[model samples]
Target: MTGNQASAGHLLRLIRTGEATTRGELQEATGLSRSTVGHRLDQLFRAEWLRDRAGISTGGRPSTRLEFDAAHAVVLAAALETRHARLAVFDLAGTVLAERTEPLLLEDGPDKVLVRLAEWFGPLLAEAGTAPGKVCGIGLSVPGPVDWEAGQVVQPPIMPGWDRYPVRRRMREAYAEHVGPVSSDPLPVLLDNDANLMAYAEQRAGFRDCGAFLLVKVSTGIGAGVVVGGEIYRGIDGGAGDIGHIRLPDRTDALCKCGSFGCLAAVASGRALAGQLSALGIPAASGSGVREHLAAGRPEAVRLAREAGRRVGEVLATVVTLLNPGVLMIAGDLAGAPFLTGVRELLYQRAMPRTTANLQVVTSSLGERAGLTGAAAMVVEHLYAPDRADARLAALESVSREPHLSPGPR
Candidate 1:
């Protein structure tokens, strides 16, 4: 973040983050001469990453105001849940142009799932009035812990048969097979945990200024995602927020999908609640079913949900105390009044007064769409990051000279 005005990428980042906007501001921010600043900005303009405001009067002539141009490319983002998938085409600015939700069973395995995803992108792009060549990257949100460098899930309880899969390669191959090649080099595919994406989306939307933010998703399974200093806190090996597997006292009889007993998810996850409700003859099948019951004012569902919240809250007390996040967002299926009330009741009582005093516990604002937003943001951030953007600019220049680059899909 220092003043290395030599990097055109650094200048672009300054413009994107609003640290600098005009030639003079760029010079002042980066401590570079006006000529050097203009030279760097010229690179950004040539790469189509920046634009100039033509008629802005700054106390005299029309001032040169720089802006990051987000209309030059598009991104494809998808969120995969246990029983459904949501995919969308977004411009670089995070605008959802075309989106669809369909039943996509995760148990179908990665090969089938990734191919189906690749096959869907072409139509989604056409619907958004874009071609495959216009896509800068793809982002995927999965309901499990992710090995980001390997670009695959790691022993996810909900997502079986996907451990150590070469997701990035398989996804690109599927796209080339179904949609055909769009460029000389392979397109970038980014993947992350669903709860992490949700937390990221929530943080970016409303709590970007908050230094510490926590989002707990209580759906078919329970999980937590933390955003610290405006970044996802994926602990070493990306297992930082797997709170569901946390063991609890005396709940050994309750079995978890992770093949363990006395875990938090085993006691309080949506799957666990659904099982309890089914045993009580209520016929609740999944988290969504429990949500439907809650919406219909089923007292039993309400009671169970509240109790589940309390149990989750019990675990979260330690988390909140440890992280001391400014915002604690409750998301996913069980994020309504009963569950939230239960969480608040227990969380506030156990955590220290200082921790609870500054914490703002709230429900989701973006709901299920949060995953899509997060995925898109992840792609945008990764592709547009300073170092990567510079590399991409170099590639663009190299691509321009290559006569064999494909123009579009079949």
Candidate 2:
């Protein structure tokens, strides 16, 4: 890559990530010469793509920190849940614009959903006044196993018949049809497990200081996102940190969608809770209903949530023993309220005190937006590759007359 490419890539990452970095810091981070960093900053400032604010004085000299101009560019992020889909427009500064959620009619499957998504983009971008060309790319979070390398959803147990779905291909094609495409620069698409995205959001956005952590989703199904050294660990085949299919020692009767009988998801997932509640004559068509019942102090709902939490915690205790993460961040519909409380109680009680001593389990701060935000983060990270960043920077400069803005991701 050219020096221009190196500068553009480094600057994009600095902006996209919302890092409050100074030129000296950027030079150190990018391993570039002071002159190179200064030259790029000048070019970006001349293009109105970057803005700097005076930062706190250091012991030697006060520094000015750089930030991306939100008005200069935007990213659109989407995530597919079992019951609905979420969409958000995010400025380069990580501000969310026009967040919208719509019900998922799974009966119609991928085609209908993809079309609806494509339709929504035009109106949404118009509302945000963001030109289609200004959008770096879109990131997606799917509710199943994903071949991140191939950008495909592969053999999703919960999303039946969606096996080997070319989600990235269809989405990029549909979006390009509506928005027009670059001759040789097709819009990039990235895919990751939805729960893993949530974990990424939690660890990077809300809990960045926590060097290692586990973010667990106890929603329609159970899944986990594991972060070590501040990076997501996708194992071989991109299935790392997927704890849903781990067998539970006590399960015997429940059958899983994967044709298993004893998985943690089979025993303690939101679907499992709904079934357990339904068997007890409670109304729980949705996990939200179960949460409402718990909030209303319904004893039965409380009892069931607590029991499920305990079961989940028991399964997690083994993982805790193995991973020894610094903290456990729980998300999803049932992860808070009565569910996570019970989990914390049970995990501490069951796991070795030494293991529990340093571990602090908490609810996710990003909540429902975590998945979408992480999707945006994914695109920002991938697009900032040194090979592509210079072209993207040039595109941004040519697309808008504004000064080059610092690109940062939230």
Candidate 3:
């Protein structure tokens, strides 16, 4: 793309984020030439990507206020997991316009899951009246160790069928086949750990003021995502915050899916809760059942969950001592339970006094929507990254001029 298109894409990003103003403001935000800025703005305005309004006079020439066209751009977020899948469409402002959820077991088989996902997303987009060009890209959350650089899901222990799936490539192929030609404006797909996405949502929408934090998602299984200094701390092999497999000091018999023993998930996750509840004759097999039992004030259910909480807290206390994050966000169904309160109490007791004193543990604000919202936020963040518009505009310009710079055969 030309320098003019690059500048316009940047301006469009700013306006979409609700930060647009006069040409002076754009010039200040991005060090571009007055003529170049005007050229870009005109290009964007002509493309219907930006709408201008006359600002109130300030004892001088009235400045034209620019705003992004809300209907001009869209985002598709796909959250794929073991038990279910969720697809959502989000506008520029992070508002979810349309979403659909279905019980498509993701772990049954990778190829089957991929085909079904394509089918699901295609219909949902049609129903929402969303077109291919309007879509910025797709952000996906997967329940596995993701090799972000390779665009593949590394071996996930819990997923019996998905050893290694080229998730990014498959999704992009499906989108391109159904949508439009994969050109400079080709649809991009991003894959990240589901819990990491939850952490992103918590960072952006939840405890925004916290300097450092950890989000623990206690659902069918337990996992954590750490954000230190406003960055997701994905470790070597993208497994830095996989705390669920952390060994509980006192237990060695409980085994993890990763072929280990004494892990937090083995002893204190939703599966553990269900197991404990079942032993107590509570029949609490699912997270929803655990919630129902807690709501019903079932003593056996509460007792076992409280014990599970203490164990989870003990594991987290070690993390607290090591990382010392300012906040600990408990998410998923177990987050709202009194059992988690027990976990919090144990966390404070087991953690160092200074760490406990400074730390604040609480339930997630976004609740069930945290994962989905995080998926949407990932798209927004990717598209709005400082250099994203530059790259996108360059690619679009190449394609617009040549119209043949499509992805080469794999």
Q: Count the backbone clashes (under 3 Å) in each candidate.
A: 0, 19, 0
The Cα local distance difference test for each model comes to 0.88, 0.77, 0.75
| Model 1 segments more than 4 A misplaced | 1-6, 401-410
Give the candidates in order of TM-score, highest first.
1, 3, 2
Residue-level lDDT of model 2, residues 209-295, one tens digit each, is 888789888888888888888777777777876788888766767798789888888877777877778889987865666667777
Better of 1 and 2 by TM-score: 1
In model 1, the worst 10-residue window by lDDT is 401-410
Per-residue CA lDDT of model 3 for 1-410, tens digit only, reads: 33443456667766665675778878767777788889888766654556778888989988888876656677788787567888888876678878888887765887777767777766777778866556777788876777766767777867767666777777777776665544223467777888888888888886767778898887777888888776678887787777888887788988877788998888877777877788877687666677777778888777777887888888888888988888888887677667677787789888879887888888888766777888777776776564775565555545557766542211
* Cα TM-score per model: 0.96, 0.85, 0.87
Q: Give the per-residue Cα lDDT of candidate 2 at 143.
A: 78
* Cα displacement (Å) at residue 304, model 1: 0.4
